[model samples]
Target: MLSKASTARVVIDLDVPGPAISRHLYGHFAEHLGRCIYGGFYVGEDSELPNEGGIRLDVVEALRALAIPNLRWPGGCFADEYHWQDGIGPKADRPSMVNTHWGNVEENNHFGTHEFLALCELLGAEPYVNGNVGSGTVREMSEWVEYLTRDGDSPMVRLRKANGRDEPWRVPFWGIGNEAWGCGGNQRAEAYADLARQYATFLKDHGDNKLYKIAAGAGDDDLRWTEALLKAVSCLGCGREPKNIFQAISFHYYTVAGTWEHKGSATDFGLDDYYRTIAKAQDIERVIRAHSSLMDAYDPERKIGLVLDEWGTWWDVEPGTNPGFLYQQNAMRDALVASVHFDVFHRHAERLVMANIAQTVNVLQAMLLTDADSGALVRTPTYHVFEMNKGHHDAVSVPVHVIERPEAYAVDDHAMELVSASASVKDGRGLVSLSNLDPEAGLEVILDLRGVEVQGVVGRLLTASSPQAHNTPASLGAVAPVELPVNPASRGTLAVTLPPHSFATVTLTL
Candidate 1:
């Protein structure tokens, strides 16, 4: 319990470098489901909107602006049902198939391996391809890798050159399967581990391209899955020397408003719903800690990393949208969620290698929302959070000690702090991100920089009058970021006040 008059003291040690934040930690995900690919990214060159080779220019620019390090593609569940052969060679000759996992919509195979690699090149992001392991065979998965990375004279290499790219594309990350416990065949942990080992064995290196294979890990806090998979992989040698086959294990956790079937409304929620969502989002820290602890039992050397491949808030679909589309609006609540997640990731930078928020556009927690009919694109509140926190990317984590913490907001025993924060330093500059989740009460954070020297400070704040405040094509800039005033410190300590339900990033020159 914290006294109401007590101000939070954040002590940042500037000299210590806790961990080097992986640039890949700030990653994004794009799936073939809904308009995430067709209208959200690819609008075709002939469309009235500005595009390059059928890909929307505005979307590309927005992603580039974020300096997104890596992007996972092809599916969430759709990856399992997808076949690589149907989406390559010629556009006219490519086959069309019904996306059974999604809305039963027909996929024309317009965007395939080539398109995805090209898009990654455009965005300067590494392409993390999810191989089809549920229905496709091992040969299909192996050849897809060969087709993309084989620079030598091979049959697949010839096809790639015939398709237009003479030079091979580098694919650094690959997923054996997604959601193996559910949409990815529903196999138990042992069975999925067997499948992962087999697929990883065949996913070879072509030329200078080395694949970092990620096995499908537990969902939420299922430590059994982690234990079973790691135990199974450890015994791969079978009475001989043991071998760890995976470079990383992936965990998927989505923050749903309530139950899966009746997830509450996206923009029509009250304070209870808002606090419940924050509590749900904070549960991710528990998931990461528990999973990492399980990994430690088998991977004590810490060679293997935890990849949060699919994460973000999943609310009920917007009204009138296709039920399977999974489209939802981003609000001020989402900004707080992003801030909290980013802080958690920074705090756990040692074991957490990468995290890709689910569905980057017009889909779950999307940074950019697109309107096909009106040709309108609006950056959401989450986008501002990402942009503001970009300074922390690749920065060394600074040890932050929070004293006199704010009391938790409790609702039925589920509690979270009113203020969340993380700090980092890079290039002689200190960066700190703080989120005040209180809906009505502002928090004044006192920075204890007794031994550290700071020349100047600048800040940016993102907040709105209502938690449901969001950006729409009709009402753009409704919940954007604004510069915050940073007063000079007194007695060798800096102070900044955060408004209720706001996320702020302060940068200090050292």
Candidate 2:
């Protein structure tokens, strides 16, 4: 490490190709909790906000720009208790229910299956539906699948026709349950593993729409759930060919700077708090690698994929907001968290096929925040990070070896790398996403481009005056990406300086 300037050497090996970074890895999640489903994605037809079929147009347009691959809906803990039938009928006639897991608020069942699918269609994203396993029966789960994907005449088909849709919607991902350890069902790992097998058995595929059944696995460092599920489903001694009970296993990890009892405030925090959050965010790489190692012991062929369905920073709600809403502001700190996460996700793309950030809008680390009364929309700092890294979608991953780097940012004993990076190539073009995790010092990075011919380089940077800097409806552009000048390659290497608490992406003309 250079004392004058925190310097690093990142080797982007173009010849040795890695896994295809699934566009699905850049997915977002929305639940029925708080404003995420209601005001977040769907306003009523009579709303003053411009909408189609009660889905917000501005939000759809903003997300469409990001080219988000898939959207997980009606969940977190809400899926286990949600009764699909009650939400399917006419809006005026649909039954109202208490969202017990979130706030004790009554939901009018306005945004049902059709509404969610419509939102996905508008955004050009696939739909991932989390099914109810805690309180729903096998028949109920089976019928829901048939209703959404069956083509010909049947009970579910007839029911779908009566509700006004003739053709089936293509739903590629289906979650068997969510977080069975706690809010989902408080069941032991062994118990939930058996239940997952039963539920997965009934989730049949219809027409040409194949369902990638994902079983709810574990959270945090709990590896027993994954082992239990793998053990229960393993057909090692059956003499016949091994059959996967589920297509994928899921896990959830959230970066809380403080404990769950008192997650630090979103907009108010010290530099130590910022570094602590970054340290926590960096833990995701370890978690993913750990989970991937476990999955390998069971399925060496790599037939199963790991779905990080819920992630992102979980700060305390903004003042004067309902605690159950989980509504928090997004800051430059959150942007770095996202940037570091993507770098880690790229490294594990071979086993990690898809990941969805906790909640999409007006929820924890949301991309956009909406004003229900004024119809105002503001894109958060996290949104810019996603937009800036859009070039990596469906792109082939490449090795980013940080041989020379700055010292880790240490908060007391916990230390996190000061620099994080990932690279990819697609169609003769290449992209390098870099983040300087240090809050007080800039880092000079030299891209050691190898095994590929480089032509030119352009860059854009997202940063703030301070780590706590955030966006509001009043100051929407307080934190956004700005053009960064980059000199052409010098001896097969591209050099750029990253500002503190910032994320930058350099596009390479290869």
Candidate 3:
């Protein structure tokens, strides 16, 4: 009864050359879109929930617990339409508008610059603001940076004083624009690159926080856009290395539930869709490979970081929630995707310096989703995945090759696999984490270590009875991580049965 599928043989050697991996890739995104702000992050001043200056204490505590290193802010497309001015000074006086792109819901400028930066402070996260390069003026973008960072006397600085923030808050990381090829204003790569240069130069040095100025990169798999940006730098007659002009080149890829237009529901989708999403999530590796190779040809020193600022599973919104809100129920499939993603990032940690799961809370693939009306918190499947992979964050990534029969599966226009794993040696230990996709079939494989010898395996597994299971607020334990055994059945190999569909981490003592 699929016994071979459960036989896992692995080998290890103590001494091996390792790759130095970056730590900052364990990052997250916080947008002003929909409930990502209001109900998700900030519960307002008068609510029964414990809060600080309108931010939820529970949310803050949870984010801190996640150890989120960096956080991108204020928008997806909202930044392009945002005037940082509207979010400063007074909340009652802040202007409001209908978020035309997302549900036409009213966006009261209440949760403005101060509220966001404050949230960042509570979480100890560096702020990455996306500027309005498409719709707003050069002066507006520049002033916003000055207001947040400049200590010297200036109108913007004075405005900061008037707004009750005496000390300058260093908003370090900045994106020159959002999706210039799309919502941030659809323009030719050449046109947007020139525009990016202008806004970046204008938002120049503010003594404390030197603006990072990340340029909008190619959409998923669109390499021409990246190439065009590399060539278009000369357009800014006052030239610099395109790499030097921007600290990072931002690329975005969302694992859509179906097609982008009608992304399928987060829950209730069939097994085919689940396998397809996992397969697509695996493509992020290829996306980074293609983009990194192009950038390498241009700047081999790897000066410019590839920032995957916007990513995560984008399934259909939950029923009754505003579709514009982009809320979706999380599942073990998402947890598996998260585990797979950590492995992908661990593989390319040097070049891919930072990445943010599409959002932090209550929106697409959130970590902590709250039922605001009920004052409840449901840890998403993605949350469990993050918790499982936390060990790989700042560790040295080691390569682990998979050799097995039940590997790659061909489906429709995409291909998926039953297994994905990454090994790393950090601090004083070796870590091997994996996610198996075949729900009905457990996996049997060998992890061969050429010369390195590891003593034992300490592992944990997040598994469920079925692929379609989920955790509602009332019933939270539909799926969860359980500790696995440490005993090795063989001398030079490891044998363990992976659950139907699960995410597990195996630690080897060197």
Q: Show where candidate 2 strays beyond 4 Å.
A: 1-5, 235-242
What lDDT tens digits, residue by residue, belong to model 1 across residues 45-138?
Answer: 7889988888898999999989989999998899999999899888989989999887999989999888888889889999999998888888
lDDT of candidate 2 vs native? Answer: 0.90
- Report the C-alpha lDDT of model 2 over 172-274, residue by residue, as the tens digit: 9999989999999999999998988998888998989999999998998788888888787664334342356799999999999899999999889998888
- Which model, 1 or 2, shows the larger TM-score? 2
lDDT per residue for candidate 3 within 1-510, as digits (tens), equals 357645444443435545565555778888877788888888889989999999999888877877777788877888888888888777788889777777778888888889988999999888888888878998888888888889979998899999999999987788888889999999998888788777777877777577776888878988888877766542223334543566778889888758878888777878788878888888889999999888777666666788888888888788877877888888887887788778888888878888888888888888988886688888887887877677776787765766564746786776776778887787778777877788678875566655566766787888887776778889777877789754454556665567778878888777
Please report the TM-score between candidate 1 and the true structure: 0.97
Instruction: Candidate 1: list runs displaced more than 4 Å.
Output: 1-6, 235-244
TM-score of each candidate structure, all chains considered together: 0.97, 0.97, 0.93
lDDT of 1 at 508: 90
Could you tell me which residue pairs clash in candidate 1? none
Give the alpha-carbon lDDT of every model: 0.87, 0.90, 0.79
Indicate whether candidate 1 or candidate 2 has the larger lDDT.
2
Reference-based lDDT, residue 299, model 3: 60
Best by lDDT: 2
Best-matching candidate per TM-score = 2
